[model samples]
Target: MNLKPLKGQHHVSAITANAQKNYEFYTNTLGMRLVKKTVNQDDTSMYHLFYADERGNPGTDLTFFEIPNAGRTYRGTDSITCTFLRVPTDDSLLYWKKRLEDHGVSHEDIRKGGTRMVLFFEDFEGQLLALISDQGNGGVKGGSPWARSPVPQEHGIIGLGPVMLTVSDLGPTEEMLTEVMGFRKKGPYRLEVNGENTVHVYETGEGGNGAEIHIIERPDLAQQRPGRGSVHHVAFRVEDEEELRRWIQKLKEQRIASSGFVERYYFKSLYFREPNGILFELATDGPGFEGDEPFEHLGEKLALPPYFEGQREQIEARIKPLNTKSP
Candidate 1:
């Protein structure tokens, strides 16, 4: 069946033990805009905070689900190990290194990752993250940084870059990504990771930093024990609900057991796990964060979807109050 390939990286969702600290790091320290403050649809007892570029664009979002007191993540195979953010130029990497130092954020000296320069770092909860310099890179374009971001526009993060996935076996995962999901192999790069030396690169739709997935084969390690700072899933972009429905149909044909169609209010989604058991989601790009709240006051208040509006008071009472208002 002929189908349109996924556009690129939509967003990366991870778990956080504390919403306040998560907000502080992604917004104040990293300088991303807090675009949405809502609860996890399935579990309204916790907060699902979204941070992105100026408009909460599809390729820019980095979200967290607050699971109060969640245990620490023990790194292993079969995990979405590291999430990369994009900086405009090679010089921006230097800017971020000093910025990370000033903020007391643990980071490594700039090093080369494939064709680009990357600076590795950890969040407050030890979420493995890196800033990749998009110097001379092209493909799916990055988003506009928030105008009021503390980090200067030239040095601020523009959008998400490549996501690192570590799995026990690479064959099934690679086949699922290529033949099933339409990702094209962009060749492999050598990186010594957990004793699993080579990392293969895959790219979909207008491939580039924003649309690549780097997979590492590490049969030696066990599955990760996920908790705080663990990535829950990574989503790829679909143009609209129509496109998302097509993707759902495609998954059904492949006999992949998926969540089918999930209405997220802001976007429609279809979730399924690949061979390695890593959750993957295909989500629509629109009916975005602005539907309930205006741009200027995006995440200031607890904005619930219409269906969840009735239980607003109860949801509010259960989840701790988080002040997401911009400074």
Candidate 2:
């Protein structure tokens, strides 16, 4: 079977301390739609909150596992360092700078990086994030804007950008991205960290925010301690389950151990760790967030998978209540 390059990021999942706090930040502060409200399948006591653009498109999704007791994230090598969200233009960046400041969310001055300008910031839980100014790079094309968002449609966050991944050594992981995953090396750029670290860029498809990955080699750093505010996994997009099955078979042929095909209600997924021990997922793009509820009423109520439907009341009782009101 002939394999195709991944279209872009399907979603980036992270751990958060509280469901209500996360909901307020993403929906009120960031102005993203709370596309899905569900409980974690592995541990039914916690919530899996999905934030995305209006239609809940794959590349636009940013998700969190709400684990109130999970301690602060320990930053180190072999972890996803920062996630970039694309904005339409430099003016949009300026709008966001003021908006974040008004909300008391401290952010960095806009800085140039290769072909784009970026503004760095952190969430309430210290999860690293950035906003990249896009100059018609197709970042704004696929996503639908939330009509009820406080941010104006012209300046709203469009979709995912280059996700930064820190690795102790770049060679093996580089091979995994290029050879195994069909990404092309797009060269390197310098980033300000403890010191200046060279970050190599890789791309799939036509290469833009959604299709890019930034690899930072940091052998000097310690291994990551996974907890709240840390990225749990980065998922790449596949067209559908047919393509997903092909990827699974290919991983088997390549002797890379994977989670096999797992049904996620809205989408199917296959999980595995990269050479540097960072978790990765290949997820299908179809059977999206509208599967369980009407698009207009998404995230309005706690959604449970079919297996959990029988235990909805108990599961709901176990997890903390969330407020998904619009700001």
Candidate 3:
């Protein structure tokens, strides 16, 4: 594919059981801004919520589809086991540790991986997450501050960090990430999970917060069962629709089936599965969260696509009501 490397992660989509709880945990606890309030396009009965930094920037988004009846997620091979959010410094990491503890959110002690320090934790629904402190590694940069957030501006999360994928075998997946996709090998490190297993790190873009992917070679685990608390897919950033179309052509040449170009309202996207069966997406960064609403009123009310406008009453009636206002 001879294209420019991806400009870090665009967003990571996951599933959650309750809309209101998901709203509170991300907005109040983690201090992220609820940037978009909408329903799932395919299933209007469910809500699709987006939370991010102050501006709802491309790489800062972490979204969820609320499905109360969806069962717990089973972690295994060919799945994104953990999603990381980048904070600026070691002091910020300490601030988060204290914050999580005060909020009764359980988290592990800060652990070292190469030059980075990682603090692992999970959301209210058991969605695996980590807060990575890069300690001035040029890889992580730029974050907008949410002035209204309880979390002070100095320690607010920057954006999406490394996504950890567990694969049955590392060879094919690693090849796909490096050769087919334009990621460069960053190095490897040991993780203390199910004993000491080595994790190979690969990165794209400028190699910081939203640019890293960690692949853990777990050949013995079972295939993951998709449900609540599991990652639906991970998206990488491209410049624009032209670049996105180029990716579609490149994937076609590689004999990989893709969803062509999907108009996602906020961003255009192309979805495909990697060799290890994990869903991957290439998305453009334009027509962002501010496309429909003004920045001051973002996520203040339910926002629907033009197609869903006709059925707004029906959709709203089916989905649960949410309150994202600060306390």
Candidate 4:
């Protein structure tokens, strides 16, 4: 059967408190580019900021809705967990270690993840995040924001490497990831090559979503409360709107609860919750980050989707300024 899996890890969007700080931490500190600065279709009071590679490609993008008035989210056993990006492993993270230090960014020293080096940290919103790699996935070039990671442009962030998630029920979510999403199961979870520390692992395509979307199965953990550190939602990609619509119907037929298609400007999104309670979104691939501004000055302007075409001024006025600030 021709699998209709996602194109790759398109992007992950989360809710944040300060759009500027979020932009700064992602770009200035992490070396990701602020590819897009748009307004949320549902609530214009917030800004939808996108961070991605050089060209603002699909699978390499990460987005956020800066909700200033929003409260803090909790991060722990019941949370959606951290998102990990892959960078060249040969001394690349060494630069990152000091980069975090020079910027005064708080982070734990390098940690071990199977055969990879996993450095975990948190954003201003307290959202758990990490950078992990076993030498990056070949040639995926990324826009490096810092001057330190001078290992050359051939190796930058090769898109999301892995995403760790905790859940009460892994059955339905597993079906969606492998069957519906088309990821190949690597095998039973393995954290050690010799079978010391084992953990679930799955793979698909190349480096785009590279070995990502990890689910931590712990039914005994209590439910999480949403505040400052929880992940809002994770988005998988479909080639186009037609593919998206097709899945919308397929999801319904599969008996998996789903949401109506939402036109999110750059791309349309369909939201739903896995049985374990983590929100999952299937978003389209097109209208990439360049839809609003040129790659050179992508985040400089106040970009708004067609939904907010006429209300741009009012919406812009309502939203407070942050690093992703605009006119």
Model 1 regions more than 4 Å off: 193-196
Residue 262 displacement (Å), model 4: 2.1
Weakest 10 consecutive residues of candidate 3 by summed lDDT: 134-143
Candidate 1 vs candidate 2, TM-score winner: 1
- Index of the highest-lDDT prediction: 1
Tens-digit lDDT track of model 2 for 242-291: 99999999999999999999999889999999999999999998899887
Tens digit of per-residue lDDT, candidate 4, span 1-327: 243666556677788777767776776667676777777777777788877776667767778887667786544454577788777674767777777788787677786775577777677766777777556344223334322322244445656667777776677678867777677675555442112434566655543335356667767666777764456777777778888888888877777888878887788889988767788788887877677677667777787766677987788688776554321
Cα miss at 57, model 2 (Å)? 0.7
Each candidate structure's TM-score, on Cα atoms with residue i matched to residue i, is 0.98, 0.97, 0.97, 0.86
**Which candidate leads the pack in TM-score?**
1
lDDT of 1 by residue, 137-157 (tens): 989999999999899999989
Model 4 / residue 179 / CA error / Å: 3.4
Structure candidate 3, residue pairs in collision: 139-208
Q: Is candidate 1 or candidate 4 better by TM-score?
A: 1
Q: Which lDDT value does model 1 have at 284?
A: 94
Per-residue lDDT, model 1, residue 92, is 98
lDDT of 3 by residue, 1-327 (tens): 568889888999999989898999998899998989998887889989998888889889999998889998877888999999988789999999999999999799998865689899989988889998857677646568588888998898878988999999899998999889989997788898545889899988788656889989988899999888899999999999999999999999999899998988888999999999999999999889887899888898999988779998888888778887863
